[model samples]
Target: MRDPVATAMQVCPVEIATAVLGGSWKLTIVKHLLEEPLRRGQLKRRIPLAPDRTLTRQLRELEDDGIVHREVFDHVPPMVEYSLTELGHSLAPVVTVVDSWGATYRWTIDATK
Candidate 1:
């Protein structure tokens, strides 16, 4: 097998961000945002795969990359919603492909267990 650390270090910055967001909940978050905006609690309820800390980290990375937009609503409840930025909308096609591939390969992947 290749050296994971060396391979990681060789990746460009943009690629690194992609790899980071490629974690369990990140793509799921983006995929949901493709259809509609969701508040933080809603996202949490939708994706129970990862811990909040991990999901939060992924969102921060996406926001830093100009892919995800976070909107804070001032109110007694203080609502916060996360949506895709223009750059994020560009990822719709990529997410579509990923979704297709996941659906196609899910059975094969599960069988390996």
Candidate 2:
């Protein structure tokens, strides 16, 4: 089946970007991954508010999008780690700018309240 959103994104760069990054937790996940590679458990602990299924789904989506790389290590108990790909690393500066904006926005809102 054809994806309408994917088709629309072809004509609109903004739409393509939004489609890739519009999820609630994707950016947050990316932000954490920027620090270093983290195991699934560690990432989940960092994002306690997000449900397990939701986090799993978001991680899968990111992996599909080439924004995240999943590494599986053979050990006594199987270990999986996630890190940003080079394409994903390109978003670090963008995320930093967005985070700065969010902080400023929150500060302004707090001052008014």
Candidate 3:
């Protein structure tokens, strides 16, 4: 999605959720952050497919949507951590359902193969 928080009206609720979290790694990132805050590098390791630039952009979009909280610690090297905001945490049920669906889909595909 070009913009996570679409300003347009008449958008379906599901459309809004997809608009905000449709990126390849956005939901996965939220799923991880739901457990605990993670440093930038940790997220990189967890989502290796997301290039550094792509991850940064997705994180920025999540932050803009009030779905993620980013904290920057001043150090010799800046340390940034990402965690879920209240809005993001609210998606726990949605993530859970998606996770379950994905697991089932994976199993079905593997069985077919």
Candidate 4:
């Protein structure tokens, strides 16, 4: 079966990149996942500002994009964990640079003000 997301992304690398990582929260989630796998609740705690449903949607989108993997264990309460895929791991450097740029930009703006 053809992957619709991949197919759509083929049109333009930049567009697809933005489509996959455009949102404010998606990159943040990716940044955290770069550290270690986390449970949903833990992720939520890390991003306390995100609404529960919004986080859920972002996670679903990330999973769909093949950037993150979700593992579920059968148990009394059920255990679910999220981790970055190999493809996702490749983005660590990019995220780091973006983070650095954001920090610099914020500092520059604050200094100017």
**Top lDDT hit:** 4
Best by TM-score: 2
Cα deviation at 85, candidate 4, in Å, is: 0.5
Query: Stretches of candidate 2 above 4 Å error?
Result: 1-5
What lDDT tens digits, residue by residue, belong to model 3 across residues 1-113? 24434642247787777678888789999999998999989999988889999999989989988899999999878888899999999999989999999999999999999
Give the runs in model 1 whose Cα sits over 4 Å from its true position.
1-17, 109-113
**How accurate locally, in lDDT, is each candidate?**
0.80, 0.88, 0.87, 0.90
For all candidates, what are the clash counts?
Answer: 0, 0, 0, 0
- Local lDDT at 111 for model 2: 100
Model 3, which residues run further than 4 Å from truth? Answer: 1-4
The sequence of per-residue lDDT tens digits that candidate 2 reaches over residues 22-45 is 787899999999999999899999
TM-score of each: 0.78, 0.92, 0.90, 0.90
User: What is the descending lDDT order?
Assistant: 4, 2, 3, 1
lDDT per residue as tens, model 4, 1-113: 12545765778888677778877599999999999999999999999999999999889889988899999989879999999999999999989999999999999999999
Tens digits of per-residue lDDT, candidate 1, 24-66, equal 6778889999989998788888888779898898788777667
